[model samples]
Target: MEHLQPSLTIDFAQLSEAGRKDENQDTVGARFPEGPALATKGVAIAIADGVSSSSAARQASQTAVTAILTDYYATPDTWRTGQSASRVIHSINRYLWSQSQNNVRQEGYLTTLSLLVLKGDKLFTFHVGDSRIYRLRAGQLEQLTRDHNQRIDKNTTYLSRALGADLSLEIDMESLETERGDIYLLSTDGLHDFIDHRTLTEKLQSSSDLEALTHQLHQLALANGSQDNISVQIARVDDIGTPSESDAITVLSRLPFAPLLKTGQTLDGLTVEKILHESERSQVYLVKTVDGTPLVMKTPSVNYEDDAAYIERFVRESWIGSRLANRHVVRVVEPPQTRTCLYYLTEYIAGPTLTQVINERAPLPVSDAVELAEQLVMGIRALHRKDTLHQDLKPDNVVVGAQGICLVDFGSCWVAGIEEMASPIAADKILGTLNYSAPEYRYGGPTGQRSDQFSLAVLMYEMLTGKHPFGEAYGKAMSLPQFQKIKYRSALQFNPLVPVWMDRALEKALSIQPGQRYEVLSEWLQDLKRPNPNWLTNRHKPIMERHPEKVWKGLAFAGWAVAAGLLVFIATR
Candidate 1:
């Protein structure tokens, strides 16, 4: 039996014309991709209407439509529809606003935009200004967007919100469940403002041919005395093609996991040179191609063969690694040949793990620690730019090579795009090693870029002190109260060579509350390299708090001297 792959299918048509204006200031576009792109990115339809008051209105509308159509597909497939569309729209708005600012005539580039995306069994809508999106399902017509316009009088009105109207844009977005046979309509104000809702609904219900229907709507708008550029777009859902959890599992498990390999054994044109590491979840191998080019191959363990969630995560790790390109992050490589089993390869890094380095050379020099910190931040920032979070940041996941430091593990990464998609697999209750994880993960609080900052700070403290920032009790602290009881052991206490300002920076990054941490990783790195004037005020604190061990030793010496004086006095008597 041949299995058919699930996919989203749609039929759409669009038309834009100058009804009474000298030039058309409305734009409409639709993209229907096939195969994997259709399944991942779905179908997109956008409509934009330029405000007539602006001289650059046509350009603004065209740019808004074109930017969303092209850039939306360029985003990582892991991102959800809203996240991807919103990012592209915001960028377009910024460009249009800048152009308007530079215009000598001061006529702003402004337009209303409405975007509709059909993915899986859902419809996602992004709207700004007075452009409207309507859906007809089960013989009922419903408007999915609100007009962003304010009226000075019954006959005069202006758009209250629009792209390029301001430096920052606030777009209205919504998601609704979709059904096959549902019809969606997108129209500019020129058409919707002139045609009544009842007449539009009646026309939509009476037409089956989308191309003719859109043309009909345009002519009707002009007949109704519309004095602006007119535009209309119509799309009908042919198939929902919703992928169930089992479908995801089936797709991911097409290739079987490879058995544990021995040295000198060949599979798929690559020979296993040595086993690098093995755990209950996965196996890492040092492999060489037929040409003797060395690489590292990671394969899922057979222990999770029946676990769909585990299999999805294992495959996702490879997918994420292949997309990231950074000098400070390990590069996932393509296989030398077609693979017969489930496994992925990466460029071989010739260096010890950060953990191994610490074991051999604890208390790394301040300069070396600072340099490594900068590299790590660079790598993590790359992931952050793509809306990814490296949930785990520890010495074991970092390799110190001659090329510099490279973050190596992606199994624990969290991608915002993927999270937005519907999934049958439950998320892990806790991600990353408990010792380096932030408190939010344990307490079920929201986690974001700040969570990674907390983990990075822990790594920095360990590099300078050869110990965890919260001591041995941190890893065991499971509850909020337990975490609260655990206090930070400053790096200076273990290595006096660490600067006071640098230690203070580490303390701030390692704050138990995520809000207390630096707003960005770069700020923390800056504080580490330079002294913060505010931290200098700590010098005025009581000496005992700053140097408790020194104070205790001095007190012990004084007590011994007093005892000796008493003994001498008694002997003389």
Candidate 2:
């Protein structure tokens, strides 16, 4: 719990009333998952309104609301907001439709369902039929979901899409970024249809207690002559628990910088043995504990002593490393007790960085390079699983130890939940090496797991061919036109040992557009080992398409030869 922070804290309330209807056919509920699930799955709120014409409408309303609220949490934490909620809605719709088919007299189970999931600082909305979800932010009321109803006249309308309306369901899903103090409202048609937007806005502004607001909305719906069951749910964002950038910078800046250590110099209980590495970023030293346990102590560069952002990044790097337990990631060791300075320690790996290895052994064996790439991808996959992007993924940030590959450097990491909070860090700033970074990162756009995959493929290309795909021009492009003009050189041109299929896979992963790359790191790793059949077709592509520069140069040479022959013929004449 000390290492991890809860991304969201919310207050929620739900109420359902029969109003003027003989039977209460509306259902509304909200639930916050416990412990780890709360952090991973967040909270879910749902409201459903049953159709008056169907005998099994009540069951459909209750079932739809219950199924989504419970099953949405059951989905894998790795799944994105849209995927998890959409899958649950589809499955519940199928069940409702099957029950309707089984009973002829009961007709079809029909209901309008609107569900909202608040995870971290994001809101996921899933809706079908006339029920609605709305959000109040910065004193403005915005309708977040669409009304799935067809109007024939002023007073006559029918639900166009609802649970069990047909064997197949069409659910409207959307995700919105959330801010602290944002209030969300989910309501059945009985409540939303009767209460106008102005009235709803007035009710929300008048109350601070969510329970009181829900009651007020229900009463107003009934007062306005709601003749059907009324149900409403209100959710207020209380807090996003992550620290702000300024707060983090302030806290980390207070720590004093560590002094350089000479061989055999003692600090606390660890004795420095040798200088491992040095850069403008930081210095690493090989050290030994009092009991002679080997370790690596990293101290921030003296140059950044007054730089708050740099200090904050260094501290965050240690925090991120401490949380990761993957074999291929460098392990950050916790201080035995309290530390005296800003430096952090890690379990030392007795090996050179991947950059050194690549330089020392150019054009590594095909199997060795592929195997190394697979291990490196595994490390990147581990970070991606936790919704973290190692923005600075390159050969220099990876170490080849006796055990295997170990990913280092988290100064440029972007954590999903943490980044959602108020931070001093600029989200749009380009991070990572230019040659390896994805094109999107260059333009100040959001980078995803795919961006990291781009970096990995670049490293793989370098390991195999000792050359960049687009050469130096790719990294120097300042505009979209310049970027688009950069050509990709085949790995086989540099090293003929690389298989055409493998080179094609690298080309796809190294696509200028992030969407053109592999969806997952594992997929690219698999392609490296076993060639994809789709890539086989790419091998037969025209020389101009596969290697544009080669064809262009050949055409230019032929044109020059023809021009020279014409000049000679004219001179002789």
Candidate 3:
């Protein structure tokens, strides 16, 4: 069947046969979920090759192929393809392993599994054992998976990893962008070992039909004297659709923004209660539906009416908020049934921004600061787990509610999967605040989860000390040297209540170089609660090393004292 959409189209086919074998022990299958599932889950294809040594090996192949096709669709639609497919593969491996244990000879039901999942414009690959998945594009064949086999000699080898081989499975996974006219080929060893690259390239160049290509591959394998069952699957991509942000920009460009909202004014079924915030990029308003449910409406700023990048980011903010459903992250509300203008709604959080809390309540208690920092880390962890980075994490972007802290702005968030797709936005521009931004950002270095950790550490230090680690020195810095010159004062200088170990933790997170910073958010979070013995033992730093200014003043004071004592002795003599 053909999977067709306005922007994306794909066709797939498969052929399998027992070659020089009494029974066919290989299984191959493909599935494309329809409707919403099609959009969310997309398509999946699986191939499994059963071992010849076992009696019920065919059962392992059939079970793995069938389970992946059926259970992958049963997974939560919101899940990313890699996560969903891996979960299903794990379950299938366990079931096959258990069946082997119940057998009389304990000769396991062994099989090799390779799976490919196409979602949006990206392909997710999962592999275990010797089966292979390959991509043929532009007359070149690229093997996307590694073989799990141990070679004893040049002529002999054995499968090192396979389904039913062990209770625990390590499946290799990778994701890549799919281009138009890309052809993906999957096969067992029977076909790949027999078909040479030249012949495969010739066949692919000659045929346009996926079904015929698969059939030709199987026939070639048989003609080349393959002893095992031959199986092959082919998928051809015709087109890829515009991503959500691009689509949103197209839809919103035709619609104009509603006039500035005032208290008691109504727009898009939401009654304006108050103006929440306003900036050059966007405006936020406290609004309520007719049912009295509170909501926060965010509208694009009139200043960015002609700016495509700004508008895309504004729309992407809502898209990101909708995908993440954590208590610490702000939730995006569905659009009203009827809308009069371009704006998005979010659950109205009743609390002050962390900036407000820090301003009015400067130098918060150590426990209180730790508590808020912990909550913010939870939100950062949520983003990181999804392969996303909140490039702009600061006190202003967080809300301090009674329930706890919630991270608010996603305009500067970077999602890994989405970033791989083509977009009008460019990466040269830096997207973060000055002082809290990691030093690498100022120098145009790549940012990742560690970059967010640096920003989080800046926030934690600011909460305790009421000052930025680098202060105003980081503002408008041009070069890496300038960033390296900025001094990071110990948090204890401002708040003695902050333990020495806590300051050291902040010190590492506040490293000028991204590489020197804490690699993971959890490491810094753990350090805040309990002191690391290594940190404690190494805390004895010289005054010049710890506080340069203090060291100079102490030296000047000693000089003045020595001069005054000598002058008194001279006068007495």
**Most accurate candidate by lDDT:** 1
* Superior by lDDT: candidate 2 or candidate 3: 3
Rank order (by lDDT, best first): 1, 3, 2
- Model 1, span 37-63: residue lDDT tens: 675677899999998898899999999
Model 3 stretches with alpha carbons more than 4 Å out: 1-6, 19-22, 33-43, 66-107, 117-124, 140-146, 151-156, 167-179, 240-249, 252-256, 424-430, 541-573
Error of 1 at 522 (Å): 0.4
Supply the global lDDT for candidate 3.
Answer: 0.83
Worst lDDT 10-window in candidate 2: 421-430
Cα lDDT of model 2 by residue, 27-83, tens digit? 888887766466556688888888879988899999998888888887655455676
TM-scores of the candidates in the order shown: 0.87, 0.72, 0.83
Q: What is the lDDT of residue 5 in candidate 2?
A: 36
Best by TM-score: 1
Ranking by TM-score: 1, 3, 2
Q: List lDDT for all candidates, in order.
A: 0.88, 0.82, 0.83
lDDT comparing candidate 1 with the true structure: 0.88
